[model samples]
Target chain A: MSSDVKRLSLILLFSPFALWIVLLILLPHIGMVALSLREKVAPRVYEFGFGNYIDFINEPIYWNTLLRTGSMSLLVTALALLIGFPVAYYIAKIAGKRSRGALFLMCLIPLWVSDLIRAFGWILLLRETGVISSFLIWTGMTDHGIEFLYNDVTVIIGLVYTVILFMIVPLVSTLDGMGDDMIEAGYNLGGNSLTVLRRIIIPYAMPGIVAGCIVVFMLTAGSYLTPILLGGKNSSWFTEQIYDQFITRFNWESGAAFGFLLLAFTSFVVWLGLRLSGQSLTNTVART
Target chain B: MARANTSKALLFGYQAYIVAFFVFLAAPLVAAGTFAFNDSLFPSLPWQGFTLDWFFNDTEPKLGMFHDRRLLRGLYYSFVIALMVSTLSVAVGTTNAFLFVRREFPYKNFFYILMIVPLVIPGVILGISILVLASNVANTADDRFGIELEFLRPGLFLVVLGQFSFITTITSLVITARLRKCDLSLEEAAYNLGAGRARVLFTITLPFLRPAMIASGIVAFLVSFENFNTTLFLVGSESPLTITMYDRMAKVGSTPVLNAVSFFLMVGSGLLALISVVVQRPAPSE
Candidate 1:
């Protein structure tokens, strides 16, 4: 009797959570796919077909937007890699115990902010008479105030500012577990530092590097707020197009197709990341 | 030894660059926090005279900068919704964390992978799903059950549900990461000490898990509070604080008060994280 009661109680606890996920997370994704195939008419009837995919393909702006978004994602991913690798190395390799926690907290602060507010700050920084321009004028970098906002350059910088932490956390955690012994051995064997890095450090952190790149890519690709706020109308990205289709034009079909394609793309990147590392994100980083 | 010295020089040089890079990475938050007290509303050129008026403008008659009624309301709603979602996520997350950590179950990998799909899936799709499902269920409830469930409407409860969908996965991941190293020997010791199974878990193990639980809970809260993509879809015009701010910004680009609000929020989140870090009890590791 006690066993049955415990079983009943456990089921009661687990079922609601499971049901919530199935209904919200799993089933809704199914609905997105369904919504993609279904054509919405005047009186709330969705006629189901492959018309949406066809329309999506027929749209050049959509493909162009996807390409632009993809490249933007790549740009940010590359910059974050260029920017994050050494910091992770330093934190994992050099920082004292007392300061490491504080350093980690610094990496996390920007991450915890609202992306909207973060983007707004970029707008505030990059605008025609904004912070960067004012600084330029003060330092006499330019004869007149400069306008940096609403361009690809600002968008790239904004995306980098937002998504860099996704790169750092994984990289630092991965690198932290790897000791200095191998590098020391390499040096002992008369290999130079550059040689050691290219030959050993890169390979050691490859999994984390790959996982971090994938995460940064997915975030930059799926990002709407940064590009929307900073990218301006001329700086059109795929997510911006998706937003237009759904909210402005009231079209769900093409929007769903666009959304699904983005999903498939990110899923492919994640799968590729898993394949690259042959491990989960946790282990890929510094082998914790 | 000479080779080590040469390599050490090189690594230190690289570390110098890294220190600079970290400073660059941390610039924005510090900048935003700095300008929160700026007398100037905009981030214009020339360090506009600094003042604490932005923090104290709540008293003026014609739009007190500091005492923004709308902004404060939004912040309050954000806190409430975040707290609710965090609690919900932690509750569910703890269950899944327990399941994954403690015992072998049927199709364990399947359930594990199945549970974390939302983590990788775009928040955009996740948002759409919650919107459709909640509305559909609400529709059916009104039709069949003759009960209009306002809580399930596109508001607080629905927002919590949407945020919790993915937030639980994060909380679960963090807790599970800690749980794998929870040293089941402790539980075994408790079991041997004339304690019941529940007693062993609650008395012996739960304290050990508290730090992770608290950290994950607070993180889940922050994620929900800042969440925009999902909330955008499900918020139904008057949803929560972030939604309200977004709507205003989207329509009219909002006021400088928003900057004040954002600054305050960033400070609030920073303090929460700092306190969490400090209050975190050091659990003896395995």
Candidate 2:
């Protein structure tokens, strides 16, 4: 193809994608940032300032819920890593080829299901009159029925269950790529199993660990259905606040500000995670 | 001998831990599936007699999910939106994948990072941002052009647009992975044989990408169909199945029919996943 023809074909093939990214993703976010900076004074009157962001700072509930959501998401990420590492190790390193495929599929099935239905599943298991409560009553572990839903513990459980697969898939891929000889070498060098795990295995799996944490943290923080359904009346999830502002209260300015703040906060957390793990964002996403 | 025994014990412990984890992961789904058949009003346990009322009952005091018109309409809308989103996403994503993987352009790194911003951003935020943008566009069109873009109004069209924004990125990533692994020598050979560019692309390149396209299409469909967080903001009067389910669960609490719906969704998605696995399975000789 000639130079002109090559350039024309490139434009023809690429403009639709470029148009999509610029029009949908970039413009909307830019509009949101613009909206976030301005404060609505009356029905149609608006003034450009940091008033929306300042409102968030002045409101204790907003910042408090923000911090709570972040810390809880971090806790969920940690719990998922703790639970996922062993299962990933088994599937990647120990299981036979056929069984490994089956195990991975088993983990993936729940991921494909809707998050709403999964939250409902937890309700069936943990609600006041649900299966576990009944079981506990039958076993004489509790008097009458105990309410297991509508609490922070239930919210954490639901969040972890919802995001565990994100952790496992990445960890499995990373661990699967590792050579078993590395571990054997550590043992040969008089290193105990825990030492080998800490020194050799964890470092080798750092990319996957970082990738999983990023995904889990984002999902847990942004989740709305799981926290609301499982946490019930007293949820106070930050996403719920965003939902209330935009949908319930019809305050798009404040909602947009909260949305931008969430994006900033999650990005910062991801950066900190990558920095602490010594893995770059490009490396982590490429691994995924 | 002592070291071997210790290792054996450790292996046993690991096996037990994996078993427990599997049970924990699966128990909720199993519980939901079982109670779908329970002949009672509540989804929770009371050892009610087994019945299919929730699935097929059309009588008074026992309406099946399938028999409910609203739920059925929600399901229909969900399928329609998912179909449109997947088709659009696949078309745009496939082209973008080729653009990124096959050819280099200026500002490619900048654009690449911008494209991924939607994926990491929260769905709630994405929904609100799109909602704000679309409304702004609608207002502009009405004021300047004296025309109303019906698609920009909150409905299936906006839902498709909102979902397409992020889902296209996912599809592009899947196709890019396949494209990277694909052998380039075949394309070069085809071109060397005097095959036209279009011919080489259709016969050599597209054939190699068919599997990834199909897999990504399935993923895009599922993501759009089950989407609630983003669709909630974009939906006007036409609610998807997820939104309807959320409303019912929150308002009326748990019902047997809800369980039935959950069971059906599980089975449908499970079958789709199984088919994808089967399609991707290696040939027997290999």
lDDT, candidate 1, at B81: 87
Which candidate tops TM-score?
A: 2
User: Which DockQ values do the candidates obtain, in the order shown?
Assistant: 0.50, 0.76
**Model 2 chain B poorest ten-residue lDDT run:** B277-286
Residue by residue across B1-286, what tens digits does model 2's lDDT show?
9989999999999999999999999988888888889988888778889999998999756789889888899999999999999999988888888888888899887777666666777888889889999998999999999999878989988899899988887888888888888899998999899999889989999988888888889889988988888898999899999999999987888888888998999999898888877766656974
**Cα lDDT for residue B181, candidate 2:** 80
Per-residue accuracy of model 2 over A160-250 as CA lDDT, tens digit each: 9999999999999999999999999999999988999999999999999988889899989999999999998679989999999988998
How would you encode candidate 1's per-residue C-alpha lDDT over A1-288 as one tens digit per residue? Answer: 387876776676567557767877778777778778887665777787888888777978777777777777888999999988878877787788878888888888877789988877776676777777778887888878777878888889888888888988888887887888988998999997799999989888887887688768877887878887887778787777777777788776677777888888778767776786676654442132
Which residue pairs clash in candidate 2?
none
Q: List residue ranges in candidate 1 displaced over 4 A.
A: A1-17, A41-43, A276-288, B1-16, B59-62, B140-148, B251-255, B279-286
Model 1: how far residue B122 lies from native, Å: 1.4
Chain A TM-score of candidate 2 vs. true chain A: 0.97
Fnat across every predicted model, in order: 0.45, 0.68
Scored by lDDT, the top model is 2
How large is the interface RMSD of each prediction?
Answer: 2.8, 1.2
